[model samples]
Target: MPRNDDLLDNPRSPRVRAVAKLAKRDARSETGLFLLEGPQAVSEALTYRPELVLELFATPTAIERYDTIEQLADEAGIDVEFVTEAVLSTMADTVTPQGLVAVCRQFPTSVKEIFAAADGEGPKLIAILEEVRDPGNAGTIIRAADAAGADAVIMTGRSVDLYNPKVVRATTGSLFHVPVAVGIELPAIIARCREAGVQVLAADVKGDDLLAARQGGLLDAATAWLFGNEARGLTDENLARADAAVVVPIYGHAESMNLATAASVCLYESAFAHRA
Candidate 1:
C-alpha cells in the first residue's frame, strides 16, 4: 500500500526524503535498499524483479509518458502514486530521471548460491572481476556477461557494489537478467570453477593472442574469464592462478581497449566459439 493515496507534493516530507537518501551508499548499507531511476531501469525492474519493489513514485506527466511501465507496475500490485516533479528531482540522481523512480530491496546471492542455481550442470561460462572499482565498467561487464550467456558473474569484495545506484543505472536492468554474486573470495571462485572442470582464462595484454586462440579452437571449451581492474588490469599473481592467459588482439595502434569493450569482445568470442 502507498503511504497515502493522495499525491505526495512535499519534497521535504519524511517519506520523500527517506527515499532520496537511498542515492547514498551509506543509506543503502543501513537500509538494505536502493533507488532505480529513469524509465528504462525502473521498467526493467518492474518487469523482471517486481517482487523486490517496495514503492513506486511517478508524476502524472511521467505516468502518461510511460504508460506501459505504470500499467505493468499496477498489474504487479505495486502502489503507484503521483508526486510533483520537485519531489522526483529530489529523489533522483540524474538531472533528468525520465520521471520514474522506485525503491527496491537489495538482491543478495552468494557465489555458492549462484552455482547451485545452475541446476547441477557444469558451469559453462562465468566472468570474475577482481577489484573493479568503476561502477560503469562493472555494470557494463555484467551486461556483457549476460548477453554472452554467462551462467554467473562473481565480483570480489573490493569490486564496486552491485547495488550502487550508478551501477544499477549503467546495467539498464541486465543486472536483474543475470545471476551476479559479490564479496566472494576470488581464489575460492577459481577453485570452484576448476572443480567443475571449467577452463579459467585470465584477460591480460601479456596473454596469448585472442584471435589466434580462437582460430586454433583453443577457446571452444567451457571457460570462466577473469578480468582485473581498469587501471591495473590483472596482477602477476592473478594471472598465475588461471589455467591460461588471454588477450584481445589489437590490430591498430590503440594502447589498450576500454575495460568494457575488452570484456565484451572476449565474452562474445567465447560464446561464438562454444556455439560452433
Candidate 2:
C-alpha cells in the first residue's frame, strides 16, 4: 500500500518531537495520548483498540519483517507512516528501538462502568491495587488479571500511573485486553464491589492462609483481590475494609512472592471457583 505523505526521515522535525514528547508524563496528561513502542504493543492496540490509536509509524525494514503488523494496521483502517531508523530511535523510549511506534489515546475505563452490570453481565473477578508504586508490578498484575479471566482491574489513586511507558510495556498488550479503572480510592472500590455483590479479599501478610479460605469455599464467589504496596503491604485501616484477608502460603524456602505472582494465584483461584 502506498502512502501519499513523504517518508518521515527528519528525526528533529516538529512532528517527531511531538511524538517523542509522549514519553513524559506531563506530555501524556496534557494531550491525553501516550506512546506505544515495539510491534507487540502496537499490534495489540491495532488489534483490540484500533480507534484509540491515532498514528502508527514504522521503519520500512520493520514493516517488512512484521508484515502482519502492516496488515493489521490496514485492517484497522490505520495508515502506517514510514520513518527512518533514526527517527524511530528518537521517538522510542527504549535504548534499542523495535522500529514500530504508535501514538494512542489513553482510554481509561471508569470505576462505575467496571462494577456496573452490562448486558446481563457484571464483574465476577477483579484485581484491585492499593498504593502500589512500582510500574512493573502494576502492569504485571493487569497482565495476570487478563490471563486469569478477570473482569477488570482497579488501580488506586496513590498507585503508579497506568499510562507510564514502563507499565504499558510490562503489560505486554494485556493493557488493551483488560478493562482498567485508574485513580480510584480503595474505599470507593470496596464499596462499589460490595454493592455489586462482590467480596473484597485483601492479600495481606497477616491474613489467613489462602488454602484454608479456598477449603472454606470463600473463593466460590465474585471476588476482588486487593494488593498493597510491595514493601510495606497493606495498612491496618485499609486491611480492615476488606471482608477478609488472605495470604498466599509459601511452602518453599523463598522468602516471599512478588505482588503480581500472589495476585495471579488469588485471581486464578477465584476464576476456577467461578467456573466450577
Candidate 3:
C-alpha cells in the first residue's frame, strides 16, 4: 500500500524533473526508464506488465475517475501516489495528461527470444519495419500486428525508438500487448526468420499483388512482412532478400497506402488466412 506522505505536489521537484526527462531518448537510455501516459496505456501496463512499473501518479480526481487502476495497483501491491495536476503536467508529454501517468522500465526483446516464445507450431506472422522513423506509424503498425494476432514486431536499426512519447501514446496500450524487437539489423532478422522456417515477404510496389498472394495460398504460410520507409519503401536489396515481394492493390486514385494502413491490411490478411 502507498503511504499518504508519498504525494508529490511540487511540479518542480527534482524527482519529478528526472521522471519527466524520460521524454528525451538519452535520458530514457541513461536511466533505463520511460513514461506511459493516459489511462489506456497506463491501464494496460498495470494489467499486463505491472512489475515494469516503478511508480504511478494521479490526481485525486483522476484516481476516482479511473477507479479500476487504483484497484489494480492495490491488487498488484504497486504504490499509487497523489500529485497535483500541475505536477502531473510537468511529468507528462501530452497536452491532455488524462490525469494519470506511470513511469515504467523499458522491455525490449531479442529476435531469438521472440522466436523461442512464439505460440503453437511457430510464429505464423510477424511485422518488420526498416528505417521507419515516424514514431506514430511505428506504433500504429504495432497495434495492427497485435490486433491481427501476429507473433512479434521487429524494427531494424535506425527505426524509431519504441519508447518515444508519441509512439507510446499512439499504441493505445497495444505496445504492451505485442512483443517488440528493436534495433536489429535487417539481414540478421531475415536470416533468423529463414532459420525459423518463416517466409519473408517485403511489401513493395514492384512485386506480386497482395490479393493474388492471399488467394494463391501464399498468405497461409508462416510469414514475416517487411515494410520500408514512407518515401522510399524497401531497398532493392531488401526486396531481393525476401522470398517474394508483395503489393497491396489500390482501387482508389490514391498513389499508395500509408505505412500503418498497408501494414494492417497485410497482417490481417495473413491472420484471416491462417485462421481459415
Candidate 4:
C-alpha cells in the first residue's frame, strides 16, 4: 500500500495548477511531460515503464474498480493523490471520469533507437503520420499499428500531440505498448527510412495501386506504410517522396474511408503479406 495525499485539494497550489495547464502543448513541450487519464492507460504506463510515471490521482471510487492500479503504484513507488470528484472532473477529458488520471514523463525515443531495433533478417514495418490533426485518429492509428505488430509510429509536422488526453484515451492503453516519436520533419524522416532499407508506401485516395490486390507480393517487398491526415490526405510533397502509393479499394458510393480505417486496412495487408 502507498501513502495517499490530498495535496491537490488546494486549487491554488502552484504546482497543481502548473501541471493542470501542462496538458496543453506549450507546457508539455516546456516540461517534457504529459497527462494521461483513465485506469487502462495508466495501467499500461505502469507495465511499460513505471519509472515514467510522475504521479497518480484517483477518486476513492476509482481505486475500487482498478485495484491493480494501486498495487502497481505500490510496487513502482509512485505517489498517489486522492482528489474530489469535482477536481477530477476538471482534470478529466471524458464526461464520465474513470476516477483516475496520471502525470507521466514523456518517452521520446530517437530515430537511432527506431533503426537499431529493426536490424535483423526480416523487413521492418513503420507507420508515419503527417500533420494528422485529430488526436482520436492518431491514437486509433497507433492502436492499429500495435495490432499489426509494427515497429513504431512516427508523427511529423503539426500532428496532434501524442500526449493529448483524447489520443491517450483513444489508444486504450496501447500507447505504452508501442514506441511513438513526434515533431519530426517529413523529408528527413523519408531519408532516414530509405537509408535503413525500409521502403516507404504512402496511402492516398487516388493511389495507383489497390490495397487488396497488391497484398502478398507488394507488402512482402517493403518495410513500412505512411498514413496521412483525414481531410487533405497526404500532401503532394510527401506522396511524391514515397516509393509507391497505395489506396484501399472502395466499391461502394462512399467518398473515402476514415484516416484510421484506411491505415488499419493497409497495416493488416502488410501483416498478412509478412505472414504468407
- Candidate number achieving the greatest TM-score relative to the actual structure: 2
lDDT agreement of model 1 with the native: 0.88
Candidate 3 C-alpha error for residue 182, in Å: 1.1
Give lDDT: candidate 3, residue 19: 82
lDDT of 1 at 18: 97
lDDT, ranked from best to worst: 2, 3, 1, 4
**Candidate 1 — which residues are off by over 4 angstroms?**
1-5, 117-120
After superposing all C-alphas onto the true structure, candidate 2 shows an RMSD in angstroms of 1.8
C-alpha lDDT of all candidate models, in order: 0.88, 0.92, 0.90, 0.82
lDDT (10s digit) by residue, model 2, range 1-276: 345366788999999999999989899999999988898998889999999999999988899899999899899999999988899999999999899999999999999789778798789899999999998999899999999989999999999999998899999999999999999888888989988999999999899999999999999988999999999999999999999999999999999999988988999989888888
In Å, residue 144's CA in model 1 sits off its true spot by 0.9
- Residue 271 lDDT (model 3): 94
Clashes of 1: 0
TM, every model: 0.95, 0.96, 0.95, 0.92
Candidate 1: tens digits of C-alpha lDDT, residues 105-194: 998667766666345576678899998999999999999998999888889997999888889988988888988888888889888887
Each model's RMSD to truth, in Å? 2.3, 1.8, 2.0, 2.3
lDDT of 4 by residue, 100-212 (tens): 98888888667767877434643378899998999889999999999999888899867988888788888888888888888898898888888878899988876766645
Checking candidate 4 for backbone clashes, the offending pairs are none
On the 0 to 100 scale, the lDDT of residue 171 in model 1 is: 90
Question: For model 3, what is the C-alpha lDDT against the true structure?
Answer: 0.90
Query: Which ranges of candidate 2 are over 4 A from the true structure?
Result: 1-5
